[model samples]
Target: MTVPRAWWARLPDPVIDAVVVAVAVVDVLLSLVDASPVEQAMAALACAALVVRRRFPLPVFLLTLPAIMQAIVVAPFAALYTLAARSRDRRLLVACVIMFALASEASWLLNDLTSDDRTWTLVNFFYALAAVAVPVLLGQLVQARRDLARRLVEIEEAREHERLLHSQAVLTRERAQLAREMHDVVSHQVSLIAIQAGALQVAATDPDFKEGACTIRSLSVDTLDELRHMVTLLRASGGRASELTPQPTLADLHRLVTTSGIDAELTGELPPGTSTTAQRAVYRTVQEALTNVRKHAPGATATVRLWHADDGAAFGVTVTNTPPTRPSLPLPGAQQGLIGLRERAELLGGTFESGATAEGGYEAILRIPAGTD
Candidate 1:
């Protein structure tokens, strides 16, 4: 079983109370030589008030003032020191100063009978001030240090929050880039498979059926080989030099549209090496726009326009398509894709905007600054 302990044992409150009571009794006994019972009783009570100085410092000081005046020689200066250290209000400090000054002057007046009494009285006043100032100065120093430590902790927490936000942003961008790469690889291969399958189905009875089947098999094998090689390269290079492979630049817009089963043409000359960031942004914008077409605008042809100038210092890509007549499949939410595209472009110091055209077609426009390339 555990044992309980008294509060005083942990905090020394009872011991402090006992010390105050003892000092009051001693002061009362000493005052009996020249003071009456009422004066002695008042002095003893005032001295005992020091035990609650931390909680009621101003009240205790006010209560002790009468006793101090009655018997200044036995005024319990120790209680005054306790009051000064415990209280932080400037009013309390000012009160203490006034009291000290009065006590010094009073003592000087009483000891003016001797020839060198002025010197002795000044020395005694200085000693009393020292007793009160030492404890007050220490308390102020401790409070100042604690305030400084708290400010430092707040600053460190703010910095840590900023670092976490930065890390999350970087991780999000990398995941988007990975999604674009996977879309390019998988979409191109799947389109080829669908085309070969259609051709083989129509020529089943023809003499060249076997040759077409062989071609389909070879295409599938080639796709698998390329996927394996890309995965191996990604693992070996550890994602850093993985970008060494030519990313789908403006030149690849035609292939992207064809793979999406859309008869689209690229107009205007496109910029070259428009920064990895810009290239990735343009690729993702086109990839997402085409995927939307495949899912929601099946059998609808699209047009893509790429414009570049200033020696590849600026570039823009826009894709637009009319809605399909047949019932379209539900496309992914436009808000999410647009948000991701906006983030990608803003990160590369660019802009992206997409909306439905007045003619019932959807249009996506992306522009990037190539100066950062």
Candidate 2:
């Protein structure tokens, strides 16, 4: 059953109790006109007990029995309804119904034990029993309705969680498809360009033409290398290890520096037992810094320093390049690599810094917490 959001439904517990007690008091006043002094007092007591019916439903129902005998039924019916609504025992409710019916006819039974009208009294007792069942059924209906409402809320929340997971799965699949397209189409085209450049470099007679062809081939090859790494990252399945290949670390740094096409020196070493994550961060920092040196400062000489600082509390890498000996060509770049390096360092509870040195050189540094693993 749907719950009401009406003003009365939202009323506070104390206000609801007060309204019920007021109705019961009016009921007692109406019944007491023809009742004896003791019956009147019992009816008042029953009306007062309605205020606590929610907290002590069974005991309050018992207190209203005397009022039932006195023909003050409003309070007794209210108490019975409260007991049925709050209780989970069907057998207990059935017993309470029988008890209420008997209490309503107790005076008749005691005063006319040998009367000829006992058969008619029996009919009246059955009638009262049937009437008492109305409140009990209504109370049980309300209780079931409340339980169903709670179940609906839980079902809605579960559906929302499932929808979120579904959206994430769809997004992951799209990224994987895009990565495949880049590797198949884009990388293939770049590879063709590089092959053509190599052929031209070998066949050209002019010295300047051969140098130009070599530069084109070099640029195309570098583009392919960067694309391969990008595609691999896009296709990663969010596991502890890559499904396709291993990521770069300090072990790969020597090869990176040597093939970077710049005059650079590798020096110093990180302490043993350094984490793979930190090693990757250090590697990327050096890689990005050197790429910057090559793009913006041609013919520059660089130094790569890997160090353990603060008595092994931290470990980091530093790359510094001297001023360019030759002017650099205008290269298209968005500076996204530096941003990525900074974000990676932050993930490992570390820091990344890059700036121009006083001697007209550029410097980049990455420091990671030692506990990062």
Candidate 3:
């Protein structure tokens, strides 16, 4: 129940208990009346028990039962509130309330107030009812609010967990795609280079040139072997696999425009000799960005810009597309394109940014370390 974090949360347990105890002590002294010494002792016990009511709620409730039946002032009301807040057993709370009401009537009837004291008994019954209900109701309300807050927290945690699972699934699919693309594109093209080297090695009649061609062919074979092993060991997720094709580089910018079946323009230039890895990343960034434009903003004319210092210190690629005039292409989308592109750039010690442009277009940019081939 919400007893642990009730309104008295601001006050330490001992301090709140001291306040309650002081109130009960004052209440007892003010309401003292002619009673047997045994009843007086019981009332005193009830007042003292209020200090430990929260710690031992059930025991305190039992201890105060006699004092309540004897009408020992506010001790019984305080006990009832503590019990209602900490305990989930409604039957016990209801039973204690009934006992309190009956005791209120008995306290009046047993007095020497006269035989026609029915009206006074009724009024006292209502007062005792208020005392019992106000605390119990207040405690229950706090309990309900605490439960609601806990449930909301749990729901938010569940949502976060689901998002993580989805991310992991996406990562698995992307890894498989990488393996497939590397095997189908890189290994195949390298095998073609090896075949040409093998032909040159046999055709050349010079010993030095033939030996160089043989060396190139052997290196290509070794690379193909390693690439095949890597791809074979990779785990593939269940998704639509694209047909393996040659990986594009900066040289294929025009082909990508034609491949995307959209009006596109490209300008600027990378450093004279950038690393193959850096070039491939930029090409994929632009390719995916254009594919996204085709998917989300159909009929949008796109512009691709490349920038790099002649010294090859750093280079950047940017693609911006004007607002689409028509609806997007009717192809399914997974929305992971920009996310993957950003990851690719950052993995290479570069930065990537994509957002709506001030001129009412969308732009994706990537900056990576400039290195020669």
Candidate 4:
């Protein structure tokens, strides 16, 4: 089955079929000595049938039975091989092989009468069966080889697709982290610079000093705007770069708690019309806290509370988890979620705090001014 390839493998289908038919004709001619007109016609039919054997293997093989009955083998052998190579039904192929062996001995079986002849016929039947089995086995081997080649190609394609998805996921994570750092650190610092420059410009007595401070404030404000756009683009990196998804807000908190994969309850609500940034900070704080509960405190129940503090100056979210009921795996992590959450809160003029509670539980809280954007 692993034999070196000959030049014939590269031949076109039409050319190969032409060659097969020509060879089958030559075989029929060589075996046609003293053959009757009916036998000659059947042999010619078998030779011609080889041209269409690839497309109609079973029928072509049946067409060669008459020639096989007249003791011609080459045409029948080719037809049986075609049948076995194309057919997927094992029972059908086995039946065809039996039919082929019977056809090869049909003339002798019809005329035999003597007991000695009967014994010889049985021996010839098995011999014919053995001979016909070679093509069937060879045809099956070729089928198996073709199937294996196709399977290997499919596996390689699947692996390539998986690699592409993995690389995309990595790129998305990196872009999101970059966006967070830019929004939380660079934007915050630039805003402060702009605010102080404006303050200095208003207070400066000299005309030159006032002009310089005003120029600095303008540039800082422009840079801060550009950074915001960049952060938006980076956060939306997984899809269209310019398109941004709706940022999460306090209204989404209930759904977040339900889907956080923890036994959690939500208890309080902030007044409506809070700034979008403050709402987002609250949402992220709860999301990160619930994630930690699932990861480090398996089987722990949690409570997420949203409340406006006394004096009505600020609102906040507090997420607390009970002690874990089951041990947790020591899963490796970058430990960036809490840090990111804290940075996000500071960006909104808020505070983030997390700690192990007195009862061996965990708590995370984010408080932001109600009026801040």
Index of the highest-lDDT prediction: 2
- How many backbone clashes can be found in candidate 3? 0
- Please give, for residues 276-368, the per-residue lDDT of candidate 1 as tens digits: 666667778988888667555656667778887667567878889887644442433647777898898888888898888898878998888
| CA lDDT, every model vs. true structure | 0.66, 0.87, 0.78, 0.86
Pairs in steric clash, model 4? none
Worst 10 residues of 4 by lDDT: 150-159
| Candidate 2, number of clashes | 0
Error of 1 at 13 (Å): 6.3
Clashes of each: 0, 0, 0, 0
lDDT per residue as tens, model 2, 1-373: 3456889879999998898898888888887787778888888889889999999999999999988887888899999999999898899999999999999889888884655579878998999999999999999998887655654654455458669878878877787788889999999999999999999999999999999999999999999999998888887752224547588888999999999888999999998998888888888888889878866786789999999885778889989999986534455678899999999999999999999999999999898878898
RMSD of 2: 22.9
Backbone clashes in model 3, listed as residue pairs? none
lDDT of 3 by residue, 88-175 (tens): 7788877777777877677566777854587777777887777778888987776676655655554455458669889988887887
TM-score of each: 0.41, 0.58, 0.55, 0.63
TM-score of 4: 0.63
The RMSD (Cα, Å) of candidate 3 is 21.3
Question: What is the per-residue lDDT of model 4 for residues 300-360, given as tens digits with 9 covering 90 to 100?
Answer: 9999998997788898989999998654445567879999998998888888889999999
Model 1 / residue 369 / CA error / Å: 32
How much lDDT does candidate 2 score?
0.87
Best by TM-score: 4
- Tell me which of candidates 2 and 3 scores higher on TM-score: 2
